[model samples]
Each structure stands twice: as structure tokens, then as C-alpha cells.
Target: MGPITSDQNAYAYSIYHLILYQKMLNNQFDTLGKLLTVTEKQVTGPIYHGLFSTAILTAHNFLTEFDKYFKADSGAAKEKIVLVKQALKPVIKEIKKWKDLENFRDHVLAHNFRNKHTGYTSVFSDSTFLRYDIPQTVSDLAILIQCIDFIGRAIQRYFQAEYDSVHTLIVQQRSGQSKKSMTVEELEQYLNQLNQEVRPAIQELDNKYGIEVKGGAGETLDHDRR
Candidate 1:
């Protein structure tokens, strides 16, 4: 078997991280949604604030990083990204409908507009200040989670193709027996762990606050708790 080339290596790197990030991003989004109800029970304000802030930052960071693999000059990278963008076109359309969320991401989530508030004698007053409504926030998170799930699955399909190709080569060298890569299995285990963490929390939230699980990974949130 020829050693993995630069393009193959890049694809593997992208696939591994894509799986890891999507799972984490899903878990964080679920945690934040549950935090909506749990904040009242927490003893310290930091627990609530920290998780919320981390999830927000992480969602932005993962999407930003996921886009970088597509920016590569490799042909495979270009083709894969094109297909991904096509697959995501519908989700993208739905996301665009939420202008308030976009505004929040632009004005607050992605960056801090400290320049406008220097020394408290701000030129712009409350009228110009950006505000987020609760319903909008919840809706934004829901849309964001769905987008992540859609993109993640599309990438997973691409990655699975790559894995199968490589596994074929590995099996060829190893004779009739087929063995999966340890790294791939480890990543899957990590994903399973993340899923486990979120399952009970989501069920608790549903039981306590009556917040429905909705769609996305939450659909299978009940399947594996161990």
C-alpha cells in the first residue's frame, strides 16, 4: 500500500476533526439548551455563564475551522467542499431567514464591540444597542444545531467513502482479515462518550421543564445512555 499522500492525509485530518467537532458542537448546543432551565438550580453564576459562553464560542469556532479544509488548494478538497456546499444549500437557506441571530453573531457572539463603549460616554445610546429576545435566541440555537447536524452527516458520508477506500488497501496488505484503524475506533468511542453525556441531561430537561428534544442528534439521544 502506498503511504497516505498529502491529499489523503488532508482528507483524513479533515474527516477526523469534522467528526469530533460536530459531536462536540452538538453536545454543547444541547447543554446550553438544558442550561436554560438548570441555571436556576446552580449555586454559582459562573457555572451558568461559563457553559453558555463556551458553547457560543465553540459553535462559531467549529464552523470557522470546518470551512478551512475546503479552502485548501487540493482538487479533492475542492470537490468535497463543493459537494458539501451543495448538500448544505437548503440548511443555509433556512439559516439565512434568522436575521436577528446573524446580527447577534456579528455584533456580539463573534466579537466584542468595545470601541463604541470606551469610558461609558458612548456616542451611541440604548436605542442603537443590539438586543436579543429569548424566543429568538432559542430559535437561533435550534437552527444552528440543525445546520451543524446536516453538515456533519454530509461530511461523514464523504469521510466514510475515504475510510472504505483506505480500509480496502489496509485489508489487501493484511490478507483476508479486515481490521479497522485504532484511531478511527477511538474517535467513534469519543463520539459515543459525548452522546452519553448529553442523553440523560436532555431527558432530565424534558422531564423537568417540558422542553422537547426536537430533532438533530437529540432524535437518538435516548438510544445509548451507557
Candidate 2:
């Protein structure tokens, strides 16, 4: 009804970016799942490496963006933060425990630095070499996807007015469509419909690829082995 304030604009942009990265992460994993199924072989070499690299980078982007909006010091409303944290406590905790993933992303994927001992690129050193656990990473990414889905649903449900207004404006600007925002009931129905469509597909992939979220003790990457 009125011009969107800067804070609202920033908040909306953060949500948009989170959704974008989340989808990218999901797409990467989905492709990986299908490739594994078709090949029926253990992950190896360039194709798997390429997909895994993109997945981890997208995951890092999602987690950092999520922190900016939902962390304690974030400018997000206290109630909204509380709601998100309460809903996603387990997922957030698991994500925080993934220091190895963060380290790999920072040192290997996102930056270029030399090993202190070898004075060579840090990509493959006896001390700095990090071997990813593909199964574990897949499980962790699944949990991250759950977090993203829950946060998206919570924002839509709790901040219906702002979400609707922002979404409507975004659609209009992007497509030049005069589409009106959905009513609360419509939003709820749409979310339910989306869940119905997405859940089975994910489950099928999981069943086909044996990708279960094993909450067992295992490092995401082996940083100790030479």
C-alpha cells in the first residue's frame, strides 16, 4: 500500500537470496543424485568433483545469508528470529558443527592461499589436504535443505503481509505482470501443494540413492589423514 522502506527492502532481498541459494543447493544435490543413480557407481573424478564443489559453495552461501537474517544480533525482529530459531534449532546446530565444511569452502574453494609448510598451493598438501566424505556431505546438505524449507514456510506464515507485498512487487517488476498477492489461505494451500510435490520426489531420490540423514559421528572432511 505504501513505498517499501529501506529496511523492508533489505530484509526482502535477504529472503530472496536465501531462497535463491537454497534452490541452487537443492538443484545441485538433485543432479548429483540422478547422476549417481544412472551410473550406479561411487563418486569420483571431474563430474562428481564439479557438482560437489558447486553444492558446497551454494551451501556456504545459504548458511552465511541465513545467519545474517536470523542470528541473535541480526536486525530481524526478535519474535521472527525466535520463531525461526525455535523451528530450526536442530538443523542450525548441525550446520554450526560443520566446521570442516566451512574450512574447506574458505581455504580450498573460495580462496587461494599457500600451505605454510610446503609453500605451495593449499589444494593438495599432506598437512592441509582435505578429503570430503560425500555421503556425509549429502546428509548434511539434506538437513540444510530442511532448514531452508522451514524458514521459508515460517516467513510466509508469520510475516504474511510483508512477504506477500514484497513478492507481488518482485513479480511485477520481473515479469511486468499485474499479479496480485495471494491471500493467506491461498498461500497456505500453495505451500502445501509444493510440499506434496517436492517431498515425494526427494524421498524417491533418497530411496534410490540410499541418501539418508545419518546423524552419526563423522567428520564432513578428513583433515587429519595425509
Candidate 3:
């Protein structure tokens, strides 16, 4: 590999943050789900609140990062952007419907600043404060998990070449060999071969996790969460 260009750096940065936020959101939700199932709310009340708040913030961060990539001038091909948008159409609609959740996130979790006249700060704040609805919020987060999964797979597919180049350069450096960049055709062949090799493993793991791959190759990988 050679010196990284500005475009590569920018692409790497966006993908890195998107994955980071996605993982955080998933972890928070997973933990919250387990906590909810246990019959120990007395002990887990504070823990649940904290985890839920973090999950909300993480979801916001994930969506914001996703929008950057989904935008018209984000350097992604127009057709790719259209496909991503179509895949995420339901998630986008739900996000638009989450006005109260957004307000709660903005006032209580993100800012924590009171509107003096309306007294909108803490959970105890007056009518203006958007009180948290645990059930509704949980349902929303569950839907957003689909968004997270789709975006994660999209990023992996869209930027496979960049990821492979970085991984190869790291491997070369570790082995004290000269770094070499792959040509476009080489990258495509590598990805095709890699997918063939990983398909069985992917299916096995999907079975373990109760994920169902419903679409053809190069299409959105859908999951039937257990």
C-alpha cells in the first residue's frame, strides 16, 4: 500500500464511526433486553435507565453518521444511494414518526438544559418535558436494530476494497514485506473468492444467531430475529 489519499481517509473515517456507533447501540439494546427479561427491577431500575439513555444517544449518533453517507453529495454513486434508501425506507419512516423520542433525547439526554418557562429538564419536569415512554422507546429501538444491521452490511459490501487494502497493508507491515496495493480486478476477484469461502461460515453463524438470509447475492441480507 502507498500513502493514503484524502478520499480514502475520509471514507475510512466515516465507516469507522458508523461501525463504532452501531456496535454501541446494539450492545446497549442487547443488555437492556436481558435486563427487562429478568424479574429484578428493584435492583436493575437505575441500571435500566442508564442503559436506555445510552441506547437512545447511540441510536442518534448512528443515524447521524448514516445520513452523512446517504446524502446526495456524499461521494457514493447515485444508484447505490438509491438502493440504500429503498432498503431503509421503513426505518426512515419510523424515524420521522419519533418526534417525542427525538425531543426526549435532545432535552433530557443530550442537553439536559431546562427551558425556564416550560420547565423541561429532568423526568420530573412539567408538561413541556417529554417524559420517556419505555415501551414505545423499546419498540422504536427494536426497529432501529434493523437499520443498524442493514447499514452495517451495506458498509461492508460497499467498502470491501478499502477494508481489504488496509488489512493487506497491515499484514505486509507485520511480516516485514513490501506493501502492495491491489488493482481493481484483483480486488474484485479477491472479494468474490472470499465470499465463496465465507458463505458457509456466515450461514452457520446466522443459524446460531437465528438470522435468516432472505435475499440473493449482492442484495440486502435480511434477518429474522428470534
**TM-score result, candidate 2:** 0.56
Per residue, candidate 3 scores C-alpha lDDT tens digits across 1-226 of: 3545665665555665666666666666666576556555243356655666665676667667777653344555455656766876776566555555555666666655354335554454463433444224444456666567667667667755655666565666789856768999999899778777877777677667666555533322333332
TM-score of 3: 0.54
Query: Which segments of model 3 are wrong by more than 4 Å?
Result: 1-4, 36-44, 69-78, 112-121, 125-137, 163-226
User: Candidate 3: lDDT over CA atoms?
Assistant: 0.59
How high is each candidate's TM-score? 0.47, 0.56, 0.54
lDDT, candidate 1, equals: 0.56
On residues 1-226, what C-alpha lDDT tens digit does candidate 1 reach at each position? 2556766766665665666566776776666666556434452355444444454555555555566763446676677777777877787566455444434445554444222333433213452232443113444555666676677777777667664555566667788656755698899898888977787766676567655545633444554332
Clashing residue pairs found in predicted model 3: 1-179, 1-180
The runs of at least 3 residues in candidate 2 whose Cα sits more than 4 Å from the true structure, single-residue gaps closed, are: 1-3, 35-41, 71-77, 112-226
Better of 1 and 3 by lDDT: 3
Task: Report each candidate's C-alpha RMSD, comma-separated, in the order given.
Answer: 13.8, 16.2, 17.4
Ranking by TM-score, best first? 2, 3, 1
lDDT for model 2 = 0.59
**Cα RMSD of predicted structure 2:** 16.2
Per-residue lDDT of model 2, residues 72-130, tens digit only = 33555555757765876776676666566666776566654344334456654463534
Per-residue error (Å), model 2, residue 186: 41
